[model samples]
Target chain A: MEDVRLLMLPGPVPLPERVLQAMMRQAINHRGPEFGAAYTESVEVLKTCFGTENEVFILSGSGTAGMDAAISNFGKGKKIASLVNGKFGDRLYEIASRNGDATGIASEWGTPVDLAALEEALENGAEMVTMVHNETSAGILNPAKEVGRLARKHDALFVMDGVTSVGGDEVLADEWGVDVAIVGSQKCLAAPAGLAAVAVSDRAWDRIVEDRPYYLDLASYRKSAHKEPMQTPYTPAVPLFLGLHESLMMIKEEGMEARVARHHRMSASVRAAVAAWGLEMFPQLDEHSAYSNTVTAVRMPEGVADADVRGTVKKMGIEIAGGQDHLKGKIFRIGSMGAVSAPEILATLAAVQHALRKAGVAGVGDGVEAAAEVLNP
Target chain B: MEDVRLLMLPGPVPLPERVLQAMMRQAINHRGPEFGAAYTESVEVLKTCFGTENEVFILSGSGTAGMDAAISNFGKGKKIASLVNGKFGDRLYEIASRNGDATGIASEWGTPVDLAALEEALENGAEMVTMVHNETSAGILNPAKEVGRLARKHDALFVMDGVTSVGGDEVLADEWGVDVAIVGSQKCLAAPAGLAAVAVSDRAWDRIVEDRPYYLDLASYRKSAHKEPMQTPYTPAVPLFLGLHESLMMIKEEGMEARVARHHRMSASVRAAVAAWGLEMFPQLDEHSAYSNTVTAVRMPEGVADADVRGTVKKMGIEIAGGQDHLKGKIFRIGSMGAVSAPEILATLAAVQHALRKAGVAGVGDGVEAAAEVLNP
Candidate 1:
């Protein structure tokens, strides 16, 4: 019998059974009406999730592909300000620097972006601003609205990496003045990994250049999408698209407002459990920063090895994520994104509590009960 | 009841049952050993399909992504001679011209590349050469070996777009001195569309530059693939990778030689049917160039409308391809690639014959019988 392992990672969250079933169908002609319907429907749902009336296009790559397209299309050869607070933030900075003349406005991991520095950069001729809405690496949700305001004030094009936020959290792209926003299928959308959906404001479209990478070119995508029987500029991952369509339908069934609320409740339960366990949360939040509603990061207790807790939980068939890069072994994250519910959250919490007690962590409390109370309440 | 349609287009071919089943599994951790093992196995099989000992990397985009990477990585800022005889060949030239100082060596559609033009460009200091191995658009297999030889003679790098050829046709990348070879999953591999495999020779690797697109960077793919658990640089389209793994395994089970022979026999049957129907083959092959074994393009009969023939067949639950771009309505294409066998071929031919007869075409013969004779013989 196969071990039914629970995936509790930040992205690539467990898919719904219907989404998996949708992917099992035989191949369909991508240039035909059936695919066109699915593609157009997915784009419609994506626009709602992005909270934008702007044009949205799907790319056959990861979230990074969407990020690359956003920057390369509108930010290339321009002065840009990139904010870095965690792994994904740094990735945006790197991609921005590679494509344009970018300046990194550094902030500590799990901390708020340096607003003064961003304003300084923008005032000093930064033509674009790049930011990560939800930093999954540190489980921090950055202030996208504030940053968008600053960018709008400076008359700079704003590109937001909403990979883990759009479908699971609140993201009003047009209201926030975001020129471009990106989301990954495997994150809050509850679809399998690989597809990236990007929304582009008319402002960004007017400024987008022609000299860009062929595969990630946004203009080509727009052109092909407007054709009869809408299609991608290149061949899409057909199965993944099918899965995404199904998942997006599910999202529609459970309205985006309800889904975001569920995510908030789930993450709050995990935080309640962490507080009950006498464990500290990883991210130190400021007024403009908050705990991510998709994933909760908790610092490793004193004298407890990361392997002892995370490995022990893994042995019990529950998989969580350890800290990446410099924060390795210092923290563990529990994802509450996608279609995750009370049952999965409770099961994961029970396993984590058992592992923590088994690892001889002193003063361990009833974390599961605390989590259950939050769930029931 | 849903209509069961047979896809006879050049790509997004009908997937095998096992491949679809493989893609139905729930998402797994992409950074874990399970994904690593699957990715490693897929790469090993891709090497065999590509017919090279050189390193192969799987990308999460379409075949165009591979083409973009192949050109932008090594051909940027260099002098490139792009051979254009079909739509795909024109695409290569377009991409090359966008990235490098490229010159398109042109020929009419459904005809061989102009060798003299290519030679002149090489003699005038062209540093790289690009050709499409199997031009799916025109159903003509370009002379990759001859083009590779010419490139080698001039000490230039050779890049072959083997998108529709590598798995089902003969593509000896190393022996042909191809510096870079790319294949599409949906073409000959019978996998879902969206994944592309690229095999890169060391010579090309040595010439690859740093200043290229971030998402399609080959160096990043190489670095990530070499890590402990083999992985793509970014989050891969996980379900497509699973489907590709199953399809590649099926190819290995059938053996490349047997697969190529099957493709040759199938396409020969298609050609045989065209001859029996008193229709003309579209491409005028040169001494070196030959009709493509993956797809067969046939000129539409005089006084027969493309919509009348193809649309009628499509109404009968069958799908064949019409000519692209300028060739639209001038010819029709039949794909005999992927896992197609006698049943599919016979059914498609029967429908096409019925459509043609209904459209008032004279001199129509028993094409199904002719195809069956070739299939059995």
Candidate 2:
């Protein structure tokens, strides 16, 4: 790597200097007043980032922590429908089952989870349905709004994983009828990676109260939200939350729609340029690809190794990811993550094409010219 | 608060500048090689700070997180006896009952959790007994060695909360026969809060593997720990862990025994001054009156408001805690947490005397001089 600060790859994307400063600022007493002010304000910002009016609880863990809390509290004694089409989708299903909720779903890599099948599964009277808004594993964005609507119609709680979608996509937690939503500081939020957040609707809140484990419980966290300064039931990751506060403000300043649009613009250009290079688009359903502008997973041509492509491109400080699990070596993922611009995308595509040619892949033609045309056009 | 960059209420004690800088170091990819280095080194430091030869697992939440994990993992499918004598001890009971396993026996606040009662309670097929080494709530130190032997004799897991004791007192986790010992980064440890640790012996590890709850499951963390550049199974308070690493190094430089002595010297001075001032200690047990080096709870003179005294001391930029729960209005808890010296203790005693007298309590002679003489003699 040419530079130590790698902005690419996956989560924990390069943070803004201000966010680092916030995390570096003197650590505060998680229970004290100063930290409470920062934590409480950070919660407010997280609520706005998720586009919800409900209380937000920031946990001092990764995105998985929020996912665990959501299902454990609300999914107790209730069936949960998990929509799995990727690695993180499996993660959702696993955590749900681990939390004592029953989960069985059908999904295939590189394809959006079948909503029709999910509806059929809901016949068993699931109390909640968990789905990843952006399935980072396969680089596919599920039809969340439609799935959420279906979940509501079935009277099941709709818990959405917005880990990869929150900052890069226009996610309206309230409008979409999402009862519980999970988000992380890494990914498109461009903050340090330790903090995870959740926004709960009244429906989910009721379930939380009815079945709450003291440690993972959200009822107390919600009640304590308004009354006290943000004292975590435990000592929290104080510095990460402060950095999250700054990141949310930056997101708000850009306006959520504007931020999402910027991502769309870059993702579109990358898709267009990659197509011109004759690489197959891995996301099966094309028109339905309203993906979070953060990442795009593409199928590698026959004999062009995913590792070779990622390795060579990384040499130019443009890090990319290879598919995980079954899809590994079959596909590559390039991110239009935080601060990725038109020029950067154009440069990255050129670098990828060069790498493919270096690996002895034939039919690599005028990739830079195509990227330049996509950028200017 | 005057032109200070940060104001910590004594601790989540004041974080050293170097500690803050270290914590701010960019977040390393948890699965990456670099994180393995950090994880391994941190575990070593944690062992040193905890005064144990066993492997230490760093949980992401607060000190209570460790308590909950300890109780859940150690006493799975069995009952646990808990010696409750303070606010924190009550927390141990709550965590014991929070989920998975464990039953507890608790005593009233300001008492030594009656080791005799605990011994009897262990016979009810309780598999583990949890106790707080330093009850921050009532400012009393439970006889940990005695409790350890009592629990081990009964073949019960001996778990202790060292949140307020580690740096201030000798917590020989191994020598004391503690199967699972928990500690936080605040109070006597003299570090910023958020990180909590648990040292596990071979016996405890077997229990952790046998009964696991996924998230609080320390075995998975240990597996990932063995893999290089320190990695946590989940996202942790990255910055706080960095601060903790630095703070651990500092504790070593001071030498653990000397640090322990410093706390005792300060404790002796506080007790002598209280006696000279004719103020009674909160603990009813005499030997318990020896006190924790970090804190002491003193009964307010009849009719003197604990809040009033604490509020006045806080105005002078020295914040002290009022008794929690029922003890709220009855007594004042003065703490000598983190890097506290004998002179600082003398200054605080002087301030306490002034605050007490101003709140309409008549004191016996010069309190500061009395404290100094107690230390010198």
Candidate 3:
């Protein structure tokens, strides 16, 4: 069989073989004991991964669905302060604004979130404040903990979008005082895309006035998940849950600290290689700007079209992502989230250098050496 | 390996090996041409399965999520007349009521929908009517076509819960004049649970006033689906779509008419075996009542405990279902949804007979013989 393309996109990450096999297991009765055990274990494992003892519900949708649950459950009729620095952050603001009265603290694309502006918004009349822990669109990590502390100071509940960071970064959900933290299975979990996990604190639950949408009703999810045979309110994506369970087990085996370090190592390696290739980083390159450990965004080289680079990479049986929305065609992103390792990262850097050379770009100084410098160090 | 338990539950039907392998296929870039082709093909196949030339969108949640999209998209502030005869139907009413002004036309759980009552409600200033094509909780098929005709007569859009009937039985969405029909992946499609499909008519799309609840926003789904590289508004469950695509291909191979016939045959055989075992069929077993072709509800014998029968069958490596909600402990259901065959049906019946006999029930007839008669005939 031909080798499968390396999936280095922000999500739907290249799944481990065991996780894939878990998804291939025979169907089980969702209402039966087998599924009950799986569901119960999945919730516990997800909480452990999120670093929270608060309530977490595994939902049968994408990360956006988790974002919807967080916003719709507590944002309706409430004063919401949303921080927007990238596409996902914009989505958080959009979801909240659609549901209730929301004030957006907007930041320029590719820029770090302004905590002072967020604090000002929260100090107004905001009851809930939303922020993305890692913004994939900009390849930057937001000041989630700082935002959480500010929200707490202003008596506003903090809802965090940890879609790309929860399992890959040091996301201390409870310690950071986040009321709701949302993540997707396909991100750092190394599972298939289809499941979203939402960690809800008592504060977020208490703010739910009524059930808005039936399918995404967090109150119902909490009630059902607390049952003896813990389960979601509706029929879950059983195979996806199985994949997640296996992925979480793999994470447990790796240990959270090791996983986070591995991700940081890969991030540093990618950034070094991009620098060696003489390409500008998309997000501000500074200590305060906070580069993402999950994905690295680099500006496209002059005279090298984004499509040509991506097309060449695809021909080499590797897949990465281009910039999204307004940043499309301006930058290319290399995602090292989930099951990605040093070998895969080195291979990706090599392929991009080859693609760049083919596009007549010069000064692509030994990509492998640059990446190994950080990976070995 | 030990034989897996026979998943004879309504949803999460035993997946074919090809479908399972398709799910195990490596993740593809959601924005790439590969997923675009898959998405476009899936939409076409789903349209074929629903027998509709109307618009179809693949969503990343349970059937309940599809129901939400249908109601939330068009039912907000519109007078809705919802027909409720079972749990799912009641859920439809609840979803619609939460979104808009709705009046429910309630019916006995195990009885068919009262079309006259629905018509009367529609005539009384109702702008939309919702009904379930097959109510799994009650193991009965509602008169959806009749209700659709009545809804049309009253100038009301008809939304249907085709969750259990879309692929298992006859569901001609366009011919039945269904403005919107919702189905789940795990049900008759024999795909893993995680995805929902909504087939919407022009009328339904025209009625969407505002995009509320960002994730379930149908307008956004339509817009993205119409793009060059067709895609979901959010990250879709890619593996589930792959499995569904394979399952749909299998359905196409079997031909819809033959598939429907096989489901009917299995339903008849299960009903016959129950009768031969001196068990009464639930859901007002009558010609007019239209028992579900996908699942059959059987009353528990006087001396037999529900758990005892279910446990015995489970021990024999088979999994059937007990009644849900109000019918729990009173009736048990035998599901013959996708991929079920005569041998499996006969084995299930024999196991049930053995369980009944073990429960101190006397004169347990040869259930295999009864089922064989229906299968062989």
Candidate 4:
């Protein structure tokens, strides 16, 4: 018999049975009323999760498509300030540079964004500001409220990548003054990948460019959404939309407050386990920055290698993430987002402990027990 | 119990059970070998279906995304001649105009493209030429080979939308000198909607623009595909890729010749049924144009209301398509693309015949018997 693997990656977490079953059905007419009802329900749930009353559009591409739409729609040929602290943040900067005249406010990965630098850029005529609320690569939650505040002070549009944070963390988009907020289906929603939803404020709509990318055009989405049956401008991934609707319904059933609390508790359990194993956290959080509730990053021990930990765990049928890019082999990340509970977390922790011991690491404490303490309590 | 639906739309046809089952699994790490294997397999089969030795990249959006990529990548800032004979043909023109300086070579809907006007545009120094191999909107197969020949003579790039043709019909991209050929997963492949694949020739690659749209950039896809296991540059719709891989495998198992023959026979069955019922085919096919083998469009009878025909059939748990845009009540389309066989086609014809008789249309012949004659003999 094949072993049942557990997925613990930052995004694309294990999907719920409901979501899976939803995709198992046959194709439906995308322009029909049935698909429209599903689309409407998913959009309404997304608005609740995003904590916004603005118009939210779902793009058929991944999270990057949403980021591209966010930037290209309103930031084209305009001076934009992009804050980069990690891989996803750097992605926003890259997309911004491609669409607009962008200035990157770079900081070390797994660290807080330089707020003063962001403010200075805005003051120096940056008309738009873009940042990632949670940098999944570094497992650091950037200060979205502060960045939004600074952008608002300068009367600049603020675009935030909430791909990994919106559902699992506290994201009051309207309260934070986020002009455009983006989320991926596979992240905190525990749905399949390939769909990205973006919430656009009315203020941001007024600043949209006339010449925008055709596939990712936001204005076209708006026009289509206003039809009798809500529809995307182009053909959406119908199965993904069905799966997303199921996942969103699950979220609604559990309630956002309960879901966020579960996510927070799960991440806390993993952090506790890491500390118990004498591991250091990867991110250096400041007053404004904090550890991400969706995923946690830990520094590898002095003598231990990433393959020894993450690779070994993979052999044991549990998938964790190693650091990306330059941080490879230096840090490992544990994702606690999207329908993960105490059982999955404890099993992952036990696997990691076993892998560490097998790697000849001394002084490896009872990490599973430590995690259970937090999870059970 | 809910009645099982028989979907016969121009695209988004009923998915095969194997394809639907493939998407019912849990999410996997997209950057891992599992996803890479799936991506590589899908791409390989796509090359076989496209009959090309050139590189084919899969984008995580719909067919429009591929169209956008084809134009925006090489046609940007160039003079592009877009051939428009139907809705999807007009879409190519729309995308071309958005990304490049484009002139639409116009022809009436459901009519052959104006080859003379297209030749004139090419001689007038059009840098790129875009055409739809199968215009699904009007169920007309445009003359891609002739268009490609003209474009080649004028030294213009040829971008063809083979969305509903490649898997179900004959599409030799390289033989036809198609610079870039695009296909949708939901169409001829009979997979779920949301994914698009583009085959790019060496000539098209050499002329690709440096500053392209961030999400739909084909160059990045090519770069990522060159990696060990092959990958899309961004996070792909993992489940959709799995479904696509399975559908492509089914195509391979059936053999391209057999699949094309089946599609042709099914469309012929429909056309024979239409002729027996005394209905007119929608498109005015000229010497260079031909009837599509993936879908058939028939003009509505003069006395019958569209609701009395299509709506009644739909109520009987069968979903065929009415016309789009101005063709709304003027024509109805029956899709025979993908894995649909004699049983489904006969059922749909029977339903339509029943509806036509009930709508008080006189001299309604035995469409089912006529279709059966074509299907069995």
Candidate 5:
């Protein structure tokens, strides 16, 4: 008896059987032709998926490693401006501060980053600017394009943490003037949680100095990628690469335009269910901030402890995430990203409704019904 | 319809079906109690496997990342002596050179590190000494215990890269005075590639200072591992962790002593087969330079091209490794690590014999017969 739970976290989402089967395949030599072809193909697919013609590399680590790469590659001795709207955004700032001279343009957790504050930091002689496309912690999608424009205007390199956005949202890395865009395999890619894909622009490459961290060295990645048969500087997580290749193929088959549309539709349904449940969204849903298409952060109702809400759902073989950092116990998050279906979303909503009611909450109109209205319509 | 090849390479060796199945398990929340329990259990198992009471932490990247961690954590502004006998030893030196002042006590490939040389380097006021236990690139097992002793005598932290040795070889971390021992999952652990486990002694912990690479920061790893329920500072490779847990369980069931004996037996059989085929061993078989019990390096016979031999064997659904760097084309390697069996070793020997014949370089007696003698008597 396999007791499978709904994986509704921001990452490590439910992987397809095909992807898992790919991962189960025998490992190939990292320097061999087999891995070379796979690496080259995967990089090309990732470039297409991220909407960037820049150099893309797959690192054998989590998204945070990619973030570190972004920061360490160009952060040294540079005045970096990090836009912080949520936990992940703050992490970028923290990483920048540790590796470089960085000034954080902080914002309220549930609000989008202020554009003027970022511009002011850049004007104050910041050489690079880092922003998170989707703040999974607060369930808010920051204005990446608007910020990118400011970064370009100030002649600063623009780095985007697209970990929770690239695959599920509209991330035109090149079009948005993003010099570097980083994504994780486990997020919307629906592979596993071991690989991070980072696309670096030519401009960013030009800015990269020799003092980069060896493990996170972009030039090494570039040289390896440029090899006739692509390779990594070190032994890669081969199974993760195979799984990512499968997931990227799936993304290609689904087409990025259709994939983004489907995410929009599914996320809308979940938001409708939340609205029907009379729960407030954690991030302010306004013109300035876009609600994350991947995860929905909902404020917990009075008397309903966040743990009880998540625990009850877990009892029903469904997993939802709770808030991080300062918002802990005050909000719960439902991630509807990566290979999630309408039926699965409806079942999750029904389970959430039951969980909420069991946690001393009432008067929530049938959540599933509300979601169905959006799905069918 | 199983077209399985003999995965006779250094790592990513043939994994048991149970380990593959464990890796197939659905994703779980990283911050959940389930992962915490799993992390705690895996760390304890790793400590036992490593033959140490030191604090162990599993990283999401490859063994190289662990090497980076070891160098960056303690080598900051400190003088480090790297005993280089092979490619991996040089890597440790390179890592140290980038992060700290490092002196390389270099030796020829396939030669065991000279204890006197290492002691001399340590005597030069070096604060740390790094070396590889089993040099996968050269198939030479360095005298780690002796080197560790030298390091201890000089009051230098001993960092051991046990990537190809930990699970299958005798690695008495504490007994050998190894302050830091790093191992990867894919090597002798028989798990998929991705995760690296590092055990740190109290002496090494005291030497850790700030200004280390952010991602490889040991203090963060220690703080997370010491959590009420163990955790990683960043998102870990969950599937790899699950696979490692299964592999660790397999190690426990087999008993470490039995496992190491089995590896020694298998590697000896392969070496015997190579001798029967009249192929010279790559590394000098002497009292000092011990051949690896994981991978056996065989010098190619005259007129027998390395690729031709490997290709011929691969045509018979067997995969062996060619040498790396300068040693490439000069030697071929047969890996007998992890979950390999007696039958598999015999088949590989037979395949190698046939391949050598096909390469027009065979006047040697039955290789399988030679290996069988070693296996049986």
Candidate 6:
């Protein structure tokens, strides 16, 4: 059996062998100087990744686990508001609701957060407002800056789950007024999943110092940071942290601007190729267009089944996703997150064109060329 | 500046490069077949690591995070008995106390669990009992099998923390009549810390299936067991899993018997060398020792502090550990965990002898020859 080279559907995309080599180093004791240096440098790199001036810390769990830490830590039962537009948005509510006082401003799946609804929630004296900046489930990029401003106006902590957007899009945590921003290594950062990096403002930290789950306590982590290599209250997966450290260095080398531009170009190219194939994006056509630079969600063409499209891509050594909730079986989600630049995007678009033609879908002539122009631009 | 290598304390022995390579692989979506295949195989290897014939499952967080899954998942909230000897044993009580009703059978640190006391607890209609098979903090190994038999005699579940013992000791989950065996990758496994493997017997499964933390539910893991590669409930740390898969294969190739023999031999070598140097092996060592095959804790000389001993080892590029809790700065711990096997042990022992001599402990002499003789024997 041949080892399968992965086309990661959502994230952490494909990793370069160079980063894998760096991750292969031996695990250091978390309480050792070697680990301390690694942890400190890694946090510094995360600060770069988050584009935040506030201190950066990592949660030794999944992206959602960070959601628990962020909301449970800062909200402290002082009413919290969440934006719900996708599975991720629902997660914010579920985690916050379980921890303390929190409410979700509901929105339909596949739609971005209506800024108005969030504004209304914040106006009601919400202690914190949480939302997924890029809801991967629906492939919609919420206006995080707008949300952050609203949080500021209402004196609420602006907590954004930048799991999908941070590395691939513009995540100026400080400049954009995002009091707390979270990013998962598996997403745009392109590290393997397992580590979650979040930058919390001092205001947010003030609330975390109070009574909280001992295991997920951020206050304890704050004190332990730098003294040891990002020592968690619990034993972390050291290998993943090593991988994250290497991946962060790789991201810096690639240049954040370059990464952001590449994702935008890939999304634009994907749009062009889909347009040529007579398919439509799931987001409103040109209206309120804040599509994630990484993943493009598109509705199936008339007579085209979502399974058929996904199966075709799979057969051709390409992987695409399908709708998660209301749009399940109705749309195709193609990811351009992490390591998806000119060559990857073009190759995938070419494969998509071939797969669609094989599926009896027409009007995809010169799909590669159409995508190439936008991808390179 | 010299590139400093980390000296991992006994609990999270540093990882080797081979393990890190596996974690550096591309991050795949949790909902992908490629990952599914990897996840399923990891669980299978996990069963073998625990020497179990039952089932193996994985959690995506730290070893402690997985500990939460272990107790919270299988514990029935009924009367539970926890053998408390050291920090880790206390952790079992903490988990049991929070999620359900628990009775802690206290033992002084550095002393083994009194099976007679545990038997009394079990006989009192205790629904479950938890034990740390190897206590890293005090270098005590509770007789799990003896306690396991007691639990069986009273029809109570037997849960063992194999965190530092699994790959380092002869952990026969089934043969020992153990119901729940919790293992971590870092300690003796030579893999990085983060991934934890748990084996559940039919008896424990009944409890786990009845009520468990939703995220840590053993039933959900069981449902996904037969699903290709392996499918975890949440976004798994892909690179680490991949690395762990590779590490397990390496362990399998070595064969379980040979691996256990290696750990036992290493333990014997370290003990013989420590005794040869006239160093005390903790307060009045047990005739039937509770010492872990992975790590050996020794009492520092009457006047020479453990902290002083550890500092010298750090300077020599070898890492040693100090005692925890009440024993802090009184005892020094040296590990024989995998990756840093015979060669590393011999080197560390030599360094320890040097550190002791420097501390004005004149009983110290060359331990390399002594350790080497034990290794050959």
| Predicted structure with the largest lDDT when compared to the true one | 1
Clash pairs, model 1 backbone: none
* TM-score for each predicted model, relative to the true structure: 0.99, 0.92, 0.97, 0.99, 0.97, 0.90
All candidates: CA RMSD (Å): 1.1, 3.0, 1.9, 1.3, 1.9, 3.4
The sequence of per-residue lDDT tens digits that candidate 6 reaches over residues A21-94 is 66676666666555667678788778877888898878777786677778767875678888888888888887
Q: Give a tens-digit lDDT track for model 1, residues A150-253.
A: 99999999999999999999889999999999999999999999999999999998899778888999999999999889998888888899999999999999
lDDT tens digits, residues A215-285, model 4? 99999999999887888888899999999999999999999999999999999999999988888999999
- Angstrom error at residue B222, model 5: 1.7
Considering DockQ, where higher is better, how would the candidates rank from best to worst? 1, 4, 3, 5, 6, 2
User: Model 2 chain B, poorest ten-residue lDDT window?
Assistant: B1-10
Off by over 4 Å in 1: A1-4, B1-4
lDDT of 2: 0.75
User: Candidate 6 chain B: minimum summed lDDT over ten consecutive residues — where?
Assistant: B208-217
Stretches of candidate 3 exceeding 4 Å from the true structure:
A1-4, A285-287, B1-4, B285-288
Clashing pairs in 3: none
Q: Residues A157-211, candidate 5: write the lDDT tens digits.
A: 9989999998888899999899999999999988899899999888888888677
DockQ of each: 0.75, 0.48, 0.69, 0.74, 0.58, 0.51
Error of 1 at A53 (Å): 0.8
Candidate 2 regions exceeding 4 Å error are: A1-3, A29-33, A209-211, A286-289, A304-307, A314-318, A339-354, A365-377, B1-11, B100-103, B209-211, B272-276, B286-290, B341-350, B369-377
Better of 3 and 6 by lDDT: 3
Candidate 5 residue runs with Cα over 4 Å from true position: A1-4, B1-4, B285-287
Of the candidates shown, which would achieve the greatest DockQ relative to the real structure? 1
The 10-residue segment of model 4 chain A with minimum total lDDT is: A1-10
> Which regions of candidate 4 fall more than 4 Å away from where they truly are?
A1-4, B1-4
Query: What C-alpha lDDT, on a 0 to 100 scale, does residue A282 get in candidate 5?
Result: 91
- Per-residue lDDT tens digits of candidate 6, residues B221-289? 778765664576667777767777777877878877888888888888888888888887773345545
